[model samples]
Target chain A: MDLLRFITAGSVDDGKSTLIGRLLYDSKSILADQLAALEKQSKNKEDGEIDLALLTDGLRAEREQGITIDVAYKYFSTPRRKFIIADAPGHIQYTRNMVTGASNASLIIILVDARNGVVEQTRRHSIIASLLNIPHVVVAINKMDLVDYSQDRYNNIVIDYAEIARTLGLKDVTYLPISALKGDNIVEKSTSIPWYEGPALLELLETVQLEKDIDLERGRLGVQYVIRPQSNDLDLHDYRGYAGKIASGIYRKGDKITVLPAGLTSRIKTIEVGGKEVDEAFAPQSVVVQLEDDIDISRGDLLVNGDHLPQVEQEFEVLLCWMDTKTLAAGNKYLVQLGSRTVRGLVKEIEYKVDVNTLERQPAPAQVGLNDIVKATIRTATPLPFDRYTDLSVGGGVILIDETSYVTVGACMVQ
Target chain B: MSKEHNYQLDYLDQLESEAIHILREVAGQFERPALLFSGGKDSITLVHLALKAFRPGKFPFPLVHIDTGHNFPEALDFRDALADSIGEKLIVRKVEDTIQKRQLTEPGGKFASRNALQTFTLLDTIEEFGFDACIGGARRDEEKARAKERIFSVRDEFGGWDPKRQRPELWNIYNGRIRKGENVRAFPISNWTELDIWNYIRREKIDLPSIYFSHDREVIDFEGQWVAVSPFIRLDATDVVETRRVRYRTVGDMTCTAAVESSASGIDDIIREITATRTSERGETRIDDKVSEAAMEDRKKNGYF
Candidate 1:
């Protein structure tokens, strides 16, 4: 079965964990032992109700404080598809965590409580999903039970979310009205809302079109590890291979390729999967690419089709999200890790800080602190190969680390 | 749609790419690294990913297995054979050896298991070799604490994991940088679920320990689960041993690893069983996790892989 990776974003009381638990519980994904354990850990035994929030609240602090501070990954499967859920906590200070969780997600579920429609956090999450280029969005209007499963309430909230999604340029938005606590529209259709005719949340998740999300133009492969045989082993004696996952596009043997930053050229002599030789490899396949000529390539080097070369620049602009407690100031040195490459870099300029909820800009911000998303220019000590985030996302994502603390302090999208 | 641009990747391919990328990072980032191989299906899959990451070449890192001295004989045999076949250096640090050095003391009882003591040997071996990175096969779907883990997790000088202080991994760009006296525990297959592993194993045709396949084994019913009677496990007078067609969902030290009643003779059969499995791989097999709800979490925070 194929995989669909999605993220769920909502405020602490939006029932993010409850929604996930309902999906798992209703689908029979939660095992007997797990359910038993959940019962044992239930805080309300007198009511004979199992606390679903305690399932994802694995951390002691999260259980005691009744809030998720970090990204919690969850996995489940139905017959049609397997799922990987990156459940990001929707808090203003934890914006970095949401970005981290949604970075690789193909789809995002922005939960909006029916009791409080069109909240600031909802807009913030939608903006992040759009900025991250998530291919799909689900504006799940949750807690319909409180609204008496009212059709007008659900429709009105969806209309509000639709305007925000359109303004943010979010693609493929789907809306669902559900009561996570009562399992309404979660696994089975809720008869209480007879006006609704959409598929259940589980059905939609299992049948979503996630395959078309990958970009397959301009073959890009960052040389992560240059494989050379230790000895005259088997049939691969003296064989040298450029090993990495195809970032995008399709590549084949005999295709002429260019080595970025070095401006050297070579032909793809062989493509092997470590099991056997193959004629061609496409985007996201981790295969060994052997060149006709022994070119000088190492980790951090990029190999692309000669016809499709990415920008090799020492200075570039990025939409940066500062993730550390330490404020980021201009002229402060840091390390930029982009794909397989890590190079020393410094902030050239801070263009602006974005207020995601209002879509306003704090122009020429003097400094950026924890969870602040800003636009900035950076100059690296050496040239690196990268694409614009819109054209090719896998190659454009970068992370900034502190020089001394060795902490990933920021995430950058090459602009 | 043109086939050229419409080449969609299956979930397995995507997971493979992820695992390969992590293995490459381990090779590119660290000075001294090793893969923690338990000879289980997860570790076996990890070895294959590392092999693909640096094939036609010897792995830059060695295979490090913290032998708990009570491992299944088949697991050790497979581990040694795999290391030899790949021509990679294999390092074995035994809990028994650590016990002899007085660095660890064995628990005494009918229910005593050495599974928890493997951590002491592991930390000692890591310090001895000064390996900056330890690639493991710990998946998040197995337990609760693992669900919130970063792909590249940081450990302190004492080898303790501080979950609250973990470095955030934003995307494919993993920060493998750590200071001296500190190390990183990398989990490439963190996103892969139990079914995903079984499917990938079938796809790749990876050879696993024979214990994973169903066979007649002498097992005793212990607390509603079947525990294989082995030399390492001393049974009580009340324990009754009987032959059963069983297979292990997870392979660890024989003393603590339980088996499930099954007729899954091959990968396809195993996949079907796993597809309909009610309990998780560890939930059904690992006795160590039965100690407490946060057993794995406590062990992980204490530097156990």
Candidate 2:
């Protein structure tokens, strides 16, 4: 089955957990024992009702304090696609967690409570999703039951969020009116809102085009490892194949490819997966590629089609999100993990701060603090093959590390 | 050594490759490294990937198992057999030994699980072995506290985790650094979820302990969880006894590891059941985590794996 990984974002108490619980319960995803446990916990509740939130709130403190402290991943599958949901904490303190969860998500579902049409948290999450380059932005206006499932109330939220979506360069903006508490537009269509005509949340999830969302035509193949058999058997002896997953783009046997770092050129002899040879390989495929000649290739090398090579540079500008408690100051050094390669980089300059709410770029900032978004210039110790993050997110990003502490301090999106 | 042949790789393959890359970097970055293998499916998968990463050569690091002394027999047997098959060095440290040395003690009865006590043994092992990096198969989906952890989580000399001061991890780059006597608990599978582990095992055709598959076992009711009726469990009068066909989704201390009633005798059956189950795999088995709201966070801060 095809995989569709998505991230959910909302402010605390916006019913994000409840919505997830409803989807799981309505889909018959809850096991018999799990439901029994939920029922048992509900009986002892101060308010007597099945606290559906308990299904996702697995932490003990979360149950007592009634708040999510960190991201919680939940998974479920429809026949058409298997979904992995990264349910991120919505508190301002946990903005780093939201970015981590949505970094690789194919779709981002931004939950907005209809009672409060547009809040700071909604805008923050929308900006983060857009900044992360999540292709599909789903605006789920939850708690429509409180508004009596009124189309006007739902439309107001859609319009308010639409403006933000457009500003963020989110091309695929989908608005769904869902009431997680009453099971409206979550799993089944709610007859109460007959004026609305759209597919249920599950159907939309099943039919969403995720394969096309990833740009296949534009990406460099980063070689992560070389797989060779060490034995002296006749069939397995003297084997040397460049083994690494294609970080991006497609590779054909006859295609002329350039190996970066080594600066050598060769034609693809063949592609092997689990010892079987194939004709073609694409982005994110962990296969072993054989070159026609004995080219010098090892780990941490970039392989690109000769026709389209990524920029090999030592200096680049990037939009960075500071995640560590230690602020980013000039002249600080870090270990950058870009694709399969690790290179040392120094902070050159902080250009300007991004106003998430206003979608405006403010004047140049002196330093970037925790949760600050700014454009900055970096100088790497070695040339790295990369593209603009907007075109190739997998190959164009780097995580900054504190040289002294060795912790990841921030995430950088190459411009 | 086979030639570069054509093949098709999936998402799981990509995840595995990323994990292998991290493993190689850990080996190169740290002076002395060890794998915290619990014989669980996730850790087992880590071992498999490590073998793939450094194939044609022996693994550079050894495997360590912090035995709580209150473990299922199947788990112990599986751990030894797996290590023997791979010809890799295996080190077993027991919490009971630490207690005997008067380093620590619990007020509870002998039947009480040594789950918490294992932390002392683990830290001692790290100190004794002078390991700078320890690889584990902790996934973010297991609990909320883990969800916030970095791929390379640094622990102080006291082995305490400072949540507020964790290093940031961006893209695929992992940072593994520590001062003298300080160690890092590396989780190569931090981004992987419970479903991903199972799917990888299925795709790779890796073997696991029999407990992971369904089987008939003697069990007793302990609070709301199903406890394996082993000699370690002190059953009360109200505790009902039953023989149920069940399997363990997680293998921790036998005293706290609950069993789920299942007839999933194979990987395909288990996969189907997991797909349909709404509750998380961790929720089905872990009793320690159900204790308090901040159970995982507190334990993590205290350096409990």
Candidate 3:
């Protein structure tokens, strides 16, 4: 079966959690024991109805506080495809969690309560989907039952979102009207609104196109681990090999490749996946490659096609998403882990912080705190192989870990 | 050499790459790391991936198995054989040793399981070795509370999991840094499901304990599930032992593990059976999980693997 990974982004009252719970419930994915547990924990069910929101709220703190503090991943599959949903908590301060969810998401479901139309939270989520380059956007106009299944309100909200989508450059956006609480137009088409026509929420999810979401034009592999036997015997077939997941593009035997930061060149001699010889290997497959020449290579080294080499530079512009409680100021050193390489880097300047709500650029703030996204330039102690985050999602991403705490303080996208 | 490249990935291949990536990160980041090998399919796959990650060289860390003493003999034998073949250091910490010290008590009466007692031995082993990182083969698809787990899960100095305070893991980067006394439990296969594990095992042709395949085992019908009759189990007078053609959907200590009535005698048959099965892998085999919905969560908080 095919797999689709998506994210659910909305506020507590926007029915984001309820939509996820409904998808699982209607899909027959919720097992008997889990449902029973849900029933047992739900103390204040209205008119003895099961509260679906309790299903996604896995943590005690989340249930007690009635909010999702971090991204909680949920999985379900229909006959056609498997789905991994990054259920990101919806709060202004929790924007980082949404980015975390969107990082790997192919599609993002921005739940807009029909009663409220396209609110600021809707725009904030949209901008994030654009910033992170989530390929498809499903604007589920939820709570249509509360609005008496009015198509005009849904149409107007769709119109409002269309303008924002155009402005934010959201590649693909599909609109659906439904009541997650009542299971309307979620799994099955809603007869209550005969005037509206669109694929059901679940159908859209299963078949949404992510073919072009991850680019594969330029081949790049960051050497994760090298396969070298300390003592070699003829029986061991102990040829020098480099093991890594292909970051982007395709690699085949006999292709001449360049190693970044060191610029060593060699031809691919053989390819092996899980110790079985394969003719070729492509993006994301963990394969071991042996080169024709005995070249010095190690972890933190990049292997790329000579014709499609990535930029090797010491300093560059990056969009930094601050993840730590500690404020990010100018000249604060951090360990930058980009691809397979981790090197010490300092935030040279605070360019500007984006106001996630207004989609406005806040220029040159003195310092930035938790959940802040900024565009800044950083200098590394060692050079790194670079590609713009827009070009290759896998190769261009970096995480900033605090030097003292070793905690990931920022998620940086190369610009 | 000029053949067209294929971007399509066999789903299992994607899972394998992700796992290998996580394993390398563990070896690189941790000062002292150990792979939690139970000789089960998941842990076995972990060792296989570690071989792919740091093969041709000694494993960056040792192999740790918390022996319940109620384990299937086949599992122990396979565990020993696999480690010896792989040339990795294997550390066995037994519950029997912990029980001998009177630090843990063996429960009495029917429904008593040594499964829960393994937690104490695990925490004690972690402390004894001062292992800062423990790599596990836990999959999120196994249990509910685990579904919310991060790839790089941090535990306190006492090895407690704080679900509320877990660091948000994004993209492929895992935050493995922890304080002096704390440790990180890195699950490389957290995204893999039961079917994924079986499919991977089949593709890789990895060896498993014989209990996974259908065999005639003396068992008792306990709580509506067929359970292996082990010496440590307290059987009541009403219980009847019968040899049933059964296979385990999961591998744990024989005391707490249940088997399904199946004739899936090989890896292919097991995969087919799993495709047709509706209940979860853990839901079918692990009776300990049925104590309460959050039993796994509560145990994990108390440092259970």
TM-score for each predicted model, relative to the true structure: 0.96, 0.87, 0.94
Give me the overall lDDT of model 2.
0.79
> Taking chain A of candidate 3, what TM-score results?
0.97
Model 3 — interface RMS deviation? 2.1
Candidate 1 local lDDT, A1-415, one digit each (tens): 6889899998669989989998889888888789988998888655676888778877777877889988999888888888899988999989999999999898998888999999999999988997788899988999999999888998899888888877887779999898888888999999878888999999999888866677666888888888877566667776778888787878888999999889999899999875478988887788888899987899888888747678999999999989999999988999999888899999989988899887788886677888889999999999988889877788799899999999999999999
lDDT of 3 at B60: 84
User: On residues B122-207, what C-alpha lDDT tens digit does candidate 1 reach at each position?
Assistant: 88999899989999999998898999899999998777888899888876788999887889999999999888899889988899
Best by lDDT: 1
Q: How far is B27's C-alpha from truth in model 2 (Å)?
A: 4.6
Candidates sorted by DockQ, descending order? 1, 3, 2
Per-residue error at B52 for model 2, in Å? 4.4
**Which candidate leads in DockQ?**
1
The 10-residue segment of model 3 chain A with minimum total lDDT is A229-238
- In angstroms and one decimal each, the interface RMSD of every candidate reads 1.4, 4.1, 2.1
In candidate 1, the residue pairs with backbone N, CA or C atoms under 3 Å apart (3 or more residues apart, or in different chains) clash, namely: none
- Residue pairs whose backbone atoms clash in candidate 3: none
